[model samples]
Target: MTDATTRGFIGQLAQGDRQALLSEGVEQIFPARSALCAQGEIGTRVMLILRGTAKVGRTLSDGSHTVLGLCGPGDIVGEASAVAGEGSARLAAVIAVDSVTCRVLAASRFRQVLRARPEIYRTLVAVTNDRLRRTADNGVRQAAHPVACRTARMLKELAARYGRPAPQGLLIGLALSQHDLALLVGASRESVVRALSRLRTSGIITTSRRKIIIRDPDGLGRAGEHH
Candidate 1:
């Protein structure tokens, strides 16, 4: 298996395995925005997010977007539906955050690969479980907490999940703007700004450009949780 920063792929195989899949008709697709692939469509491939971010969400009759989840690099964009074989395109659109390069795996070819790599089933299950838990947890916070508290909780969670520990505490990769923070925590942009201002004034958080420096993390947690 080749170690890709985001998605896992089988690579460096013997010449035979490489030739086997090449004959099975796997193609790459570069889809643009507002592209609607309906449910029960004959799905020919699974997509792995190699770059950029996409929203895996459903559409309402009002034509509004209810973001079911977010997919970033290293994420499996579609597999469950592919596994089932017959279902509507449960996910509506995967709009390009920038540009995306998806390594498409045809269903028949994918099944053959899976037979050779039975362990992939376990890996897929584990990944699905993790994503499910994350979505459930995010739902609870968005429903239960106010914006400021939600933002704090999200930052703490993000720090633990994706951020690397700095000597000072934890540095979240992006210096998230108030707007992004609002979207993440399901709060109004103005509210996120107020909360961030409060956090700054309290000296519990600091920022350098797009990175969030969580100063006094415990204190920040206490402040957010208590309020």
Candidate 2:
């Protein structure tokens, strides 16, 4: 068995499993903000992200949305619908947060791949469990943590998962708006603004034009510990 990683589906598979999976899909590129899948729509395929990040979320009846998670390189999307059988509807929407490249396999082909490799079934179970675990953790943080702590923890999480070196500091790869950040942390937009301002004032982070740079990741992490 391969080591577990946030890289998602294909990442859990061994070389042989990976190759066999790739053989079933065609690569496609999507620009930032493109919707890869939308809630309530019948899924016809599954996507394996090869590069960049995608946001997974569901739209509410009030026109608001909740961000469930982010998907980056090696993550798979739409698998649940595929596993439910063809013509199954999506439970959420997945949109590219940056320019993305992905391998898309038609539903019929994906089902075939599942049956052909029993090992893949095991891998699928593992990946699905990891995703569920993350969702549970996020819920706990939102319900129990204060907004400042939640915001700080969110920065730490993003930096750990997607940070890239920059002259200024470690740039978080996602270009998240304050509203989007609010959605992720389950805080009000005003509260998120205040939290970010506090972080900036403390010299733990800096933000500009939708980009957030972590100036002191250690400090930011510590902030998350506060009630």
Candidate 3:
């Protein structure tokens, strides 16, 4: 399979299986800043993102929120809890970062489909394992890296996953505030702002409003490695 085909839940599916899965769910639109799934709630359904972006995160014991990851088109959210069976609490919150379209399936029905399609189920398991591995890597980076290095690595990741070619550089498709970056990298907002400023000053990136463009990806990568 191509890299794209193996990356996300929907992408991993065969054409017929993709259509069959979507046919079993209802389409729903979630507005920006709304919660698609809240942490700690007993999840009843899973959502397959059809368009736009969402932030997957959780509130800590001290009531501070940390961003776990970002999900965009073709990604699946809430499947872990949904597959864990009826009474399992959601492990994270999925909030719409922009207006998002999703295919929503009841947990029970989702499980039924999985049971009937072993291949699809296996693909889902692989996707889940990949996510877990990335999460663990992010944890290790947070513990070892400086804010600037972590910020550079995070921007590199975002650019690879969601960037599009533009006149200036690769424009990150997702709109993100500095606060979002801070939460994602486990740094203070002020520290993230400083890191961004350093990157901007170095001509490695440019930002306007909530948009960011990578002007010098090679330089950014070097910064991530050196610091």
Poorly placed runs, candidate 2 (over 4 Å) = 1-6, 61-64, 166-169
Tens digit of per-residue lDDT, candidate 3, span 30-119: 999999999999999989888777999889999987789888777888899989998999988999998998999999999999999888
lDDT of each candidate versus the true structure: 0.60, 0.85, 0.87
RMSD, every candidate, angstroms:
5.6, 3.4, 2.8
Model 1, TM vs. native: 0.67
Least accurate stretch of 10 residues (summed lDDT) in model 1?
1-10
Could you tell me which 10 consecutive residues in candidate 3 have the lowest summed lDDT?
1-10
- CA displacement after TM-score superposition, residue 38 of candidate 3 (Å): 1.6
Ranking by TM-score: 3, 2, 1
Worst 10 residues of 2 by lDDT: 1-10
- Model 1, 97-162: lDDT tens digits are 434555667665666676786566556677678777977988888887777887778777656544
Could you tell me which residue pairs clash in candidate 3?
Answer: none
Residue pairs with backbone overlap in model 1: 6-74, 7-74, 39-88, 39-89, 40-88, 174-210, 175-210, 175-211
Best by TM-score: 3
For model 1, the superposed segments whose C-alpha errors exceed 4 Å read: 1-42, 86-88, 164-181, 200-227
Runs in model 3 lying further than 4 Å from the true structure: 1-7
Error of 3 at 37 (Å): 1.3
The global Cα lDDT (0 to 1) of model 3 is 0.87
Q: In candidate 3, how many Å is residue 78 off?
A: 0.9
